[model samples]
Target: MSVDGGHRRITNRLFYWMAGGCGFATGVVGAAFHLAVDRLLQWPHWLADRLGTGPLTIAAGAGVAALAITLAYLLTRYIAPETAGSGVPEVEGAMEGVREVRWRRVLPVKFVGGVLSLSAGLVGGREGPTIHIGASIGAALAEWLRLDKLDFHALLAAGAAAGLASAFNAPLAAVLFVIEETRRQFRYTFRSYVAVIVASAASAFGMELVGGTAPQFRIDTDALPLVMLPLFMVLGAALGVLGLAFNKTLLMALDWRAKAFARVPILYAVIVGAAIGALAFVMPMSVSGGERLIAEMPVADLPLKMLALIAVVRFVGTMASYPVGVPAGIFSPMLTLATTVGLIFGLLVEMALERSSFPVPPLTGAAFAVAAMGGLFSSTIRAPLVGVVLAVELTGAFELILPLMVTCVTAHVVAQVLGGRPIYEVLFERSERLAGRMPSVRSAVTSSPVGIDDPPRSETR
Candidate 1:
């Protein structure tokens, strides 16, 4: 027994070391992916500028986007269908011992496919793919290290936390996200909790070293009047409705694609990619994951009509691109859509204030943008703590925590009352029903005996 204990201790140490390494690597790879995509997207702009012929440049740009998206979908369809959509569900399911983690397939396909899909001006975020990538790394290393099934799940969560931290430089929020958002799958043990913290810290540090430390969004407003709490709640309720609409629309789109277009995903991809490509050519801000759009919101100060138009385009783009089954995330896109709604709401409030005699601090666009982001995310994702923490952390606006909590929780409750299930839960259900019927569709989960207190599975061990 003494000898066995000694070996167990040494094995645990090695697992920790490997898990830490995976976290560091997640940061590095995530940063590199960001840089690479930025540079890759720049080439089209560079070519267009040099070409000096708008038609020629536009055609060239569209062609490249079409080709890149075509290749990305092909890779996903033929190689690994698991690399589709927001991968948070995939990681969550893996933790529950439901789906297989083929890092060998996931790592390369996600890297290459994510680059192509994102660079092609799709409405998606890189962080979701990065999470999948990070979990794959941990799973691969755990297999190489011969860790038990229990440790495998722990390290996987640790890696996912690291990936999210690397993406937004929000280590604490990332940890909370793993613990809160994936609470059903993730069982917190002392070793697992420590691993998650260590990994998140390492990922944040390493990513900052590579990508520089900058808040994802800069907000000038520090606080809101207490009188605005009711308004914030109203905003949350609006966002809750928006969230329900967004989820219903996206799922409907997915169903339409599955029923009507699954037979020819490639052709469908080309048509969708070309439309997005054309939009990219005409209005670059209307396409892609929407970081640029978010950054421009405060400075551009566009009119309500223009903002509404842009918001509609963005919403359509998100709905169209997401259901096509490529490697991408809806988080950033959803945030973009929600921010637009907030802007519209703020504009209406500002108009109301202008007409009224009440004197209060005028709400800034930045404030509404940030608040609505969390509110809609809370409603759709059904992870209010993650949404609040993420907003506070990413914006570095701890002052808004009170308003955020109010907004996020309000939205969450409204969505619950409206009977709109979380988007991921809906996706998981779709996956199960479609798995056998559709060759391209795959389930994120299956019934597994592995639970929080389950002993190590003999097969996995």
Candidate 2:
């Protein structure tokens, strides 16, 4: 066989092995990271309970947590800025060949920073960091094996899916997330698809062995009342608007911070920490990641006015916490926002039909809130399938698949009609423009011209 044919065969084999191996490794890392964060988060709550007071009254506890979170953000910004924020945009830029991956720096920094930031009560999710870390691992391994760039890209993609799979224990959702959201950059083919599936499955298997196979949420299976469907649709539309507003608020916060504190970066984080500390005293729910709130929201008998207040606080708090270049994500905040709205809507419906025999259980609102969590993500990100699958896996609400699908599809359509772009895409463009200002080695090579006698080209001669 010719050299080219031999090289092709070797590349194909390497691609498969790298993709599979990276996926498995990502699962292991992601699972371990998630478990560690969960354990660490328990400490503050335990301490608060021991003191016979809420988080606010425990002054020492709240101060320590805020300090730790602020330090983590500083470390991320100073050591590895790329690991800051959701990290989804970084992977997208890498796939587009617009950004280079420095695995040596990114992997460790993101892992440590993510653990610290999340544990310190930052309003973010582990999945974002896990995704970026997993991709870094894949790319590093591929480089170590001396694989070609194309094969490396495949492995990176597979690892990203596997990371998400392990983080949420949702393999199918992970695969669909990469396929749908990364469609613009990913070269979709039979081989790539198989690689993604294998990675997701392996990650899921690993998570099951370690964390068990239970879904994230324990939602009731009762069908949503027909009367509530219209309410859900309206919630979907509102969420779409909310999503846009969320994005705008985040950008504005960042802009304001940049302009106000152009010289002293640390002060930015200090101010946020101070604000969070104060907020913790008044409204603890508005400060930390929405995980605890999400879990407790179903059982809380909050009035509509209270729920609305919490929703507004969460929205503003998320915007404030995120603008300081912290290594965090929006998933938790988005879920909290949706749940708040859904709960309020359900309360209104209950008051309107108080005389009816068929009363809407609180769990129904919880379920709709869960479904809206996915719908808002789908609409904002324009990845309906991923959003739907993520909702099912996170909440274990597969029985409500029909309603979930309806909510997500409708939200996606509305978001598109409203002229909104996917959140990650917007961030990626921002990063690209920032990175473009720096000089690159590729410019040198492309700038040089080929001599007439260079080599016999493939052109007709």
Candidate 3:
């Protein structure tokens, strides 16, 4: 090989190493964050058991949640405002050169604030904070090593993939998420994306070592019959409508919060946190991220009315929780809400089938619940492939892939027909307008065409 070729080969290898190392570290950190949040989450239930059912027990729960959420909100408000909410939009903006990562402030604030807010029984997912934290870790590494702008960008994407992989224990889904969800922002190149793949694998490895190899949600069922495909499509269309409403309501709540609590935002946090915490006493399923509820759905014998009530309560709680200026995400809550809606549909179908004397399995509702996860995700995120893969990975429900695909595709198409935009993209634009800042005119990295054989320049940031 020519000298230039040899140098390029070595350079690619080094870049891969850096990306993998960053991913591994992110996985380690992400696992610890999950474990810590899980442990902290038990506190409220433990307290409830010890205190018994009474106004004092409720008051204690409310006070603790209020204090935790308030502290978390203050950290983001004073230390790093960009760490507010899920931080997904911020990371996307940073990728487009429109926002700064501010790793020094972001890393610590996001970690502690996320723990406090999520463990306070706020209805939000941990994945968003983990994604932001992963990107920040990549940023820190790139800055310390003084890599080129292109490498820095690549590392950020890799870190994001690693974060999701660790969060869901789904490496392939993580890679797809970067490729599909962040496609607009991510700089696509063979080397860069391969680095992403490597990082995702390493992150998944680290996550498994620390968090065990079990799927995030464990529910299994037989393969869905092709005859039932139309039902899944209908389910998808329903979820599309739900997704549109979800985005609209969330944005409306955010706007209202901005106008009503502009000066005293912390008060909003106190109210939301206290309300949710107290409600946890009577309705624990409606207050949390809903992972436990989702896992238990296969066996839980909840009535249809109770399911509807839980869904409504969770929908309102999620809308209230996210706008409290605390670190939170909608992914987990979205999954839960979709599951409830799907199970409702499934139960209704079973009732109709029974009236007609058709046999229905006990686990059929669970099948629909699993498929709805991908459907709603597809509609909300506008990334059908990622949604399908994520659901399959999270549940290990390979048999449901056919239904998942039908649901995701129909959901995507229906959401588009309804003129609903991808939630993250809308959020990014709104953030830019709110901050009164224009996106930077200069692109971060320019390189050869996506699949070409060229290395990025060595210019330092």
Q: What's the residue-level lDDT of 339 in candidate 1? A: 76
Worst 10 residues of 3 by lDDT: 1-10
- Which residue pairs does candidate 3 place in steric collision? none
The CA lDDT at 373 in model 2 is 79
Please rank every candidate by lDDT, starting with the best: 3, 1, 2
Report the lDDT tens digits of candidate 1 across residue range 266-384. Answer: 88788877777767768877888887666568567789998899889899999999987888988889888887888888888878877899664644566777888899999998888
lDDT at 227 for candidate 2? 62
TM-score to native of every candidate shown? 0.91, 0.86, 0.92
The CA-based lDDT of model 2 is what?
0.72
The full ranking of all candidates by TM-score, starting with the best, is 3, 1, 2
Kindly give the number of clashing pairs for every candidate: 0, 0, 0
Maximum-lDDT candidate? 3
lDDT of candidate model 3 versus the reference:
0.83
Enumerate residue pairs that collide in model 1.
none
How many residue-pair clashes does candidate 3 contain?
0
Tell me the tens digit of each residue's lDDT in model 3 across 276-333: 7797786788887988888887678688998899889989988888888777777889
